[model samples]
Target: MSRAKGNLAEDKACKFLDENGFMIIERNFYSRFGEIDIIATKDEVLHFVEVKSGLDYESAIQNITPQKLSRLLRTGDVYMKKNSLDVDFMYDAIIVTPQDVELVDNITI
Candidate 1:
């Protein structure tokens, strides 16, 4: 997808998360490993969110391959260590489609 479209989806994802009571901490956090799309906190746990958009949920979700997940994990670790954070955290994904935005939490590698 184009960068513009990705940003739009991320903007929508941020709105969705904010409305759901998550406090947005950062966006596009980059490290040598990769980039994390969004970082938020809710109920004292940190969320590392990856925004994926497509015509449907399955198509969008499929974009998060194993290699991509590994990158996310490594980047998340870099984020925590760099910030000196020791809080609970989990990898997540936000699937944005024409119909709605969905959050899939606790994504595993």
Candidate 2:
């Protein structure tokens, strides 16, 4: 997707998260490995979130392949180390489709 489209999807995802009571701590967090689209905290657990949008849920979720997951994990580790955040955390993905949004947690690699 184009950068503008990606940005718009990310914005929408952020809005959805905020509405659902997630406190957004950061967005577009980058490290040598890759970028994490959103970082949020809820119920004391830090979330490293990857945002993916598509015409359908299948495509959106498929975007997070193993290589992509690896990059997100690497960046998440960098973020935690840099911020000295030693707390509960997990990998999450927010899938935004034309009809609805879905949040999937603990996306273990």
Candidate 3:
């Protein structure tokens, strides 16, 4: 998808997360490995979120391939180490569709 559309979906995802009690820490954090679409904190756990959007949930979710997940994991590690963070963290994905935004937590590579 285009960057504009991706940004829009990320915006929606951020709103959803904020409304659900997550504090937005950052957006579009980039490292040599990859970009994390959103970073937030909830219940003292840091979340590295990937935003994916399509006409439907399955189509959007399919975009998170194994390689992409690996990139996310590496990027998340970079973020934590750079910030000297030792707290609990997890990888997650926010699927944005026309009808809804869904958060899938604890994604593993």
Candidate 4:
């Protein structure tokens, strides 16, 4: 996707997360492997979120492939180690389409 679309998606995701009670911690966190789109805390658990936007949910969700999940998982590991976070965390995705945005949590690779 274009950078503009990605930015829009991220912005929408930030708003969605904030409204859902997650305190924003960081964004666009990078590691050697790849980038994590968003990081936040909900209650005591940390969330590593990926923002994906498209004309529809099918196209949006299609972007999150196994390879992408692997990269995100690797980056998540790096983040936890760097931050010395021993609490709970999970991988999540915010899918944005023309009509609405949806949050999918604890996604498995």
Q: Per-residue lDDT for 4-106 in model 2, tens only?
A: 9899899999999999999999999989999999999999999999999999999999999999999999999999999998999999999989899889989
Error of 3 at 6 (Å): 0.5
The better candidate by lDDT, 1 or 4, is: 1
Model 1, 1-109: lDDT tens per residue? 9999999999999999999999999999999999999999999999999999999999999999999999999999999999999999999999999998999988894
* Candidate 3 local lDDT, 64-100, one digit each (tens): 9999999999999999999999999999999999999
Give candidate 4's TM-score.
0.97
Q: Model 4, range 4-109, lDDT digits (tens) per residue?
A: 9899999999999999999999999999999999999998999999999999999999999999999999999999999898998899999999899899988874
Error of 3 at 58 (Å): 0.5
User: How many clashes would you count in candidate 1?
Assistant: 0
Model 2's alpha-carbon lDDT is: 0.94
Error of 3 at 37 (Å): 0.4
* Consecutive 10-residue window with the lowest summed lDDT within model 3: 100-109
Q: Is candidate 1 or candidate 2 better by lDDT?
A: 1
Question: Roughly what TM-score does model 1 have, to 2 decimal places?
Answer: 0.98
Q: For each candidate in the order shown, give its overall lDDT on alpha carbons.
A: 0.97, 0.94, 0.95, 0.95
- The better candidate by TM-score, 1 or 2, is 1
Q: After superposition, how far is residue 40 of candidate 3 from its true place, in Å?
A: 0.2
Return the top candidate by lDDT: 1
Off by over 4 Å in 3: none
